[model samples]
Target chain A: MAELNRLWEKRRTDNFQMQLRYWNLIGKNSGLMFVLYAMIIIGGFYYKRWLDGLPEHFPGLLLISVVLSALSVRAPVRTFIQKADQVFLLPVEPELGGYFRSSRIYSFLVQSFVILVAWIVCMPLFFQMAGRNPVAYFLVLAAAFIVKGWNIDCRWQEQSIDDLIPLKILRGAISFLFLYSVTARLFIAVPAACLLIMLLSGAFLFHRQAARGLLKWDRVLDMENKQAMKFLRFANLFTDVPQLKHRIRARKLISSWFPVRSFDREHVYDQIFVKTFLRADDYFGIFARLTIIGMLVSYFIGNGFYTVFIVAATVYLTGLQLLALWKHPLPQALAGMYPVSFGLKRRSFVRLLFALLVIQTVALSAAGAAGMKSPAGFFAFLAAGLVAGGLFSLGYTARRIAKENR
Target chain B: MDPVLSVEHLTGGYSRQRPVLHDVTFDMNPGELVGLVGLNGAGKSTTIKHILGLLDPFEGEIRVAGRTIRQDRLGYRQKLAYVPELPELYEQMTLEEHLQLTAMAYHIDRTTFKERSGRLLKLFRMEKKRHWFPSHFSKGMRQKVMIMCAFLVRPDLYIVDEPFVGLDPIGIQSLLDLMEEMKKQGAAILMSTHILSTAEQYCDKFIILHDGQIAVQGTLEMIKQKFGDSRASLHDIYLAVARGETKWLN
Candidate 1:
């Protein structure tokens, strides 16, 4: 018993150390903690006022909280416990139960603290609108807490919530109806009907898991760790990862145009970069995703067309220019062995960088111009893109070349 | 034959405060395969880094094909090729793409690249794998790809480090055979390895580094006379030198 306690303490210490290492490296930058809390408090007060007299937008507070919670949960906290390491540390498995139990308790307290506070403060508002007695409100609130707690615990255990698809959908419908119910007592039948529906739906969720019952709690934990690790790796993309799992895709067309195949070395280099851009998923993925999202955002927001065009163009160009510098260090290993000259490589990179900027600018500007009827805005937008994408990339390329020479 | 590579009074590291490599000197002649033997962190890599000009020499210059790197950066580098300790390929590029990029960087004519790469691919037994992405390749295969690319250029000086790692015995033999062929064609090879027996058997000269400095450098005959151990093998000499049991002739 004493040994197990010691082992649990050691595991907790190790976990704490790992957390400290990450926080020390990149401190908590998520504005969700404070900003969301403030918004929730302010929103609850406004919601109470509306619920007292005008009962239409009372559900707005619930919708807002759901959005905030969803964002908070998916907010990309990158510190993941490694499953492989856990497997290696399996000799201390007995101790891990207690350790994880403590973690589960801690997580429950911290995560639900905000929701609890919000519910308490909004009690008057929920009662005023729904015209519910204390007993009814407490029962509903109890049910809400149970559902939230179960969901959060399931998530921590790394079980797929997707497995409960129908139940989840049903619950989602019920919650939406619950939100709607706050508008009037006519909606009371809706939420009251949902309460019965939820108990039934939750039974289905538990039964599905029971039918193909898993004895491998460890495996469930492993899956949870893996899910956590995946999120961490995605977050690491914006930070430094020593061993990154880079998505590699081959492009054969680029190889065909090699050896430049022509005296106009500049033209050959231009063709190579174009092929590289088209073929390489890493480079192409960045450009395509940014452009697609930009277009979509513009479509939805209905304004800021020029803003989308320029922002997307700047992102694509900056990445290309920086890539030129990174490629510089690689060529050194080959430079001494082959007849490849630094001057030629420099020229190729410079030309490629310029060509990419030029091609993208023309394609994007034309697209923007076609949609935009304002001739002055179109031309001004194109010119701004040319300066930001063209002049900036070229200037940076030149600076890199100079630095390489040094 | 004239020496293909010469490093004299070289002193450099990644930084000034703590130099990884101290004043070091060695030479490799045409048709000679000289192995650089050392323990880990003993500056074997740092020495190669200096030779490749990935690092600048703080005190002395590195000369490839009888020209200082600084005097003619392009010309000096043009004469040598390096296969790093671990092959670092562009994950997005295929085997063929790597060959193509090397050909372009070296300015090989299209016809020549096609002709040479086709032959080299068959030589390395990687003809069918040309269009395969590097990510799909195993460690041995990735190392082979790196080897194939280095050999494609046929540079005057080949700077290969830790080549035996990630190579099957067959791959190792093939690489050694290629090195021998390159040597016969009058190219110089500066290779670093922990495999002393292989170095003893194949190398025309040896440079054993200890504590980031040259401990002993010469042919077997020269080392025997200098160390006064005529019967001792290369391994013995290396151990003795590393452990400070023997003093090498300055």
Candidate 2:
């Protein structure tokens, strides 16, 4: 409907304003950007070396990563684009075609950027194994990219791969064969024959899926687009990008923390912090993600006290970073006038922060120590986690006090 | 009854160098509904901010329940509840969670919190939607959530900035009735609004602020007497004060 399209446009405009506001608050931190680009370049180089042995695996891996990335991009980007004023634009639904097209195109480009880099890195490895036949490789790469673009667009329409399973399986197989045969450095005729078979198989699958579906592509596209938008909201926290609120049904597990009985202010504050951290995406997401990363590193890198130390540091950093926003901008109106005593409020907040740090550290350190078979390392890491958490809490309190006094 | 809120020689702004309100002073006694009138960028919010202790007074002091925040931070703050012009409920928090948090922050007992929260939720007709997050709420619903949170604790003073902007007619009536009931209990209200007709009907006193200073302050009859214009309405007086009408001043 015309109304829905208008709503989408208005939402986009409002989201742009919010993004600008956030950026203004935190001036462009170019250092973080530089570090990210540097990592990408470095990772590209590392992958190139790693692919020297099993060159056939590179294309398949790149294909999987690209598809997954495209699917994941929708959630955060959509959430970012949704504005509070979107209700006003609700009537312009008929014009949503333009908006959806532009969104899909933009998402495809972003999704492709990383894939292109990965492709470039793996290309050399393929050539080295298959002999430097640039023409054949370029032709295949071009075809693959075209298929990929279409695949992303299709995915955006269909959403889950289950909706078009045959197409997905066919695409996966073709991509697999394309990488496997070509990079195996087989005979030129063999690759040429394989490419022809893949082309026919993909064309058949596309036609089959395209024929069976009588439903409007736009409607499907809208649903897929919304699904993407939801994921984007969750992703925004990681990259300071826009996203929709990833609507997740909260699991009804351990619902015991309600209507806290502790009359003491400290206990009440603790319950508030604990309940929020335990249930919400924002707090637990950071804790879970950082700890997972630490566990991965320890698992792959060989574990010890060093592993526990790194996990502790990560857990502490996660708690500190997550709580940083709340401590700033001084809810100026409510901050000064709240019923609770300043000293008591600060103490409760610090205690809450400490509790969060303890949970995160204990979970990660225990996992790290379990991997390392070191109780001593666990104790050491726990101490380090506590100290780091305490210092971080103190720093926040000091900042608040200083701001108030000033 | 004692004055619930008093501002003396207040001057402050979002920034220190550029003051929005200059030498502004007024008082609101218990059970009085005082409308704070101002044009766009007339420093209504700035003055309210100073009163809430969000911004420090560059040249004055604000007292809620007869105690300045600086002198007795907790006691000063405990007497007032502020409903901002825009609802800023935590998007992640459910309506009930928001009420619970407010109750906890004010240290209300469990029994009192339950009773107050239930009554407020029903008053706003949001009892069924108590478990819903602000994310799922409409503009009016979000505003209702904010109103519920502000009223959950029976503070001596209620400072509401633009409370009627997003409400339905019934919601507006509900809010007015709630304020009326609170007033009967000797609570003081300092509400800022551009909605003249509503304020004119409901407010017992008016403080017309122009260019960050009090242009005039008093009950309707008192203001009419001072301006020597019994025929003029609150809107007329507001416009006269805002435009700095030479004749009215004379």
Strongest candidate by TM-score: 2
What's the TM-score of chain B for every model shown? 0.95, 0.96
Tens-digit lDDT track for model 2 on A1-406?
A: 5555565567667766775665553445666568878999998788766765564534553444344334332321232233332454345534555666666665567656656665665566556655678886665555455545655555544432236666566555555555444444457776576567655654555545544554344345465467555445634644544233233334336435445565555554455455555555445666677768866665455456567567657865786666743443323333344566655655666666766667777776676667767777677767777777767666754465446532
Tens-place lDDT per residue, model 2, B117-221, is: 888888888989977776788888888887887888889899999999999998899899999999999999999999999999999999888888888888999
- The runs of at least 3 residues in candidate 1 whose Cα sits more than 4 Å from the true structure, single-residue gaps closed, are A1-79, A83-226, A229-286, A289-346, A372-389, A394-404, B11-25, B58-60, B115-139, B247-250
Docking class of 2: incorrect
Q: Write the per-residue lDDT of candidate 1 for residues A229-303, one digit (tens) a residue.
A: 564565453444344334444545544655345423334344345555555434556666555554444334434
- CA-lDDT, candidates in order: 0.65, 0.68
Worst 10 residues of 1 chain A by lDDT: A71-80
TM-scores, all candidates, are: 0.64, 0.66
Q: Tell the DockQ for candidate 1.
A: 0.24
